[model samples]
Target: MTQAQTLDHTSDQSIEHRIGTAVNQNAAHTREGLLERLFGWFFKGLVYAQIWEDPVADMNALQITEQDDLVCIASGGCNVMSYLMAQPASITAVDLSPAHVALNKLKVAAPRYLDQNAFYDLFGHANKDSNIRALDQHVLPHLDQITRAYWNKATWRGQRKQMFARGLYRHGLLGQFLKFAHALCWAGGVKFDKLLTAQSLDDQNAFFDQEIAPLYDSRFVRFLANRRASLFGLGIPPAQYDKLAADTGGDIIAVLRERTRKLFCDFPIHDNYFAWQAANRGYKSDGTGPVPPYLEAQNFETLRACVDRVEVLNQSVTEMLAAQPEGSKSVYVLLDAQDWMNDDQLNDLWHQITRTARPGARVLFRTGGLTDILPGRVEGAILNHWRYDAEASTRATAEDRSAIYGAVHMYRYEGA
Candidate 1:
């Protein structure tokens, strides 16, 4: 090769070093002992209960356009399907879990094919007979083998296929974990029935002072708070668990109560379904409202067709970036995935993102800290190209429901 060719190859290697490939990636957490892995999975079952991440908020922050081709992580497939509402050109949903992939596929295929009423009945009135009927008559036959097995064959407590057989919407690994917490609180004499009854600000404040406050000061809640394994259900990592726990510093229940209070006090309880699921274990019945297309009224066909335009795979953001056709994609929705990354991962992910970004392409993600993700973590070369919307990010942070994250950020990839 000539001198010019050698210089070109050297520069390519440098770029790869800065934006590492998937081959350089490791599991987000190092390989833990078998017991740790088991515990982590168990915690994942609990903490991930009911997809705690806010899809509606994500949609709003992303401001997706129909011309955009979206690549995103499929946590529960909620956001992926929801993204379709924006009429994006295409969506690629990737997940690490087979179960998540299966769930996303079912969501994409089932809703569009089933009757709109049946679609709402299934996802909206979840855990009801109408939902069960919809599943049996319209959805069951259509589900892929893995999803069908997840519904009809997976056994827990010898109750095989109960999530579907019993119309249990909140009974997935996450849902069951939540129910476990409820059982724990009930057994420990924390009256959840009374705690959930705050009709107004006055009622909420009174309940907080009279009943919930006492529980926050309780011995049981404190014990539960210390068990790092107990919080795994919420998808908190070991490091994050330390931060979350330390954020309390002393009284776990009080700190926890304050965090939960944001969902109730700042935002209307009725509007934040995440709060509803946390407080009430389910959303109020109107059925179609506030849900993705699959769960919307008279919109199942739109959702089914929309699903066809979406592809769900088990891959990381870096891997997605590597395989993307150059200049083919116009948007990337990270969705707080970066909050889970260490600096190395963040740098590599951004490197690939910059390479694939088309002019004016937008990138949006949420963070756990008040400052944006760019300052300390993102390198100078890529950071220089992207303009940070500090004002917008700040405004969004004050309104964020996931109290732990610092801010939600949006950026457009500008050329060097």
Candidate 2:
């Protein structure tokens, strides 16, 4: 290839190109492809203020040990930070979104300089003026130049400062999406705060059946729900949206209703920080309620000590894994990213995963559909190195407090 061809080829493999390729699976002129591009655009900026996946269930599946090396997709960095509590040897977090990379870096660095209470005020309550202050004084200096530049970008700085002062989880695409959904429910005479007040599962069930279920049944809401673009706020791409629709046999409304029901009724509100975000758009202000393990008071010291062990990569997980030595990392947390991949991408990812995995390595991921997505997608020759833990995956799926995903799966690398 000539120099000009090489330059053009390099441009096609840029992070922007990867995101485009991952999301735009359909024909460019098609409706599905249009929504895919829209999701890609939205995903370019801040998509998640807090990751929706349950780090607790993830840790349970990983059973991370001191000897283990982990690589995870950094959504909001909660799981990456929380994994420190497991005493992993090191963690490498990679993401295509620059916003997510910045957020993850901030979360990893803040615990080092701030006291537990101050840390809680910033990330836990996530709505104090002190958070921006903490970012400037404590976390900012520790963050890498790229992360610092991301937060300092004049266009994004104000919105991010406002997010920190108001509530970290109350901003972002996912946050704003939930805010809109909440308002839609309120307009329909449903209140999430009322559901939070329920003390028992039966009460939660009653609240959902009476108040929440009807909103899903609304013609206007159902119409909105049917469109893939409506879910862009949830950080779900068109590819995953197809699986979600398929999960309910094309009844997207039913899928929405059932997922929402699981989120509200499957667990108690006080113990579920995911529920807190769904209801209140932030963690408890009083500090007695559940929060991410990294935000817990007892884990503060652990986070501070282990924060140095984290490596934040602003790129695709497949690219990051490809740079690692053979049999390097033992734990992989894909966090539903495979749902975004095409057949070639999936095969490429598994090849790297199987290449980099150590003995008894565990790869944990979630899906938007009930079925195993890897089958017939990832090449069987490549898959020969791994075995699916069906029973553990089912239990993990049930144990996941986030309650949004259809399934959580585990693949163990038992060797070829």
- The number of the candidate with the highest lDDT is 2
The model with the greatest TM-score is 2
What tens-digit string does per-residue lDDT give for candidate 2 at 251-307?
888888888889999998778889888888887778888898988898889889988
Point out where model 1 deviates above 4 Å.
Answer: 1-36, 43-49, 129-133, 143-146, 157-161, 167-169, 187-199, 245-255, 285-294, 298-301, 401-406
Clashing residue pairs, candidate 2?
none
lDDT per residue (tens digit) for residues 150-181 in model 1: 55554545433345435344666657657776
**For model 2, what is the alpha-carbon lDDT of residue 331?**
95
Q: How many clashes (backbone N, Cα, C below 3 Å) per candidate? A: 12, 0
lDDT of 1 at 102: 59
Lowest lDDT 10-residue stretch of candidate 1: 16-25
Q: Give per-model TM-scores.
A: 0.80, 0.95
CA deviation > 4 Å runs, candidate 2: 1-13, 156-159
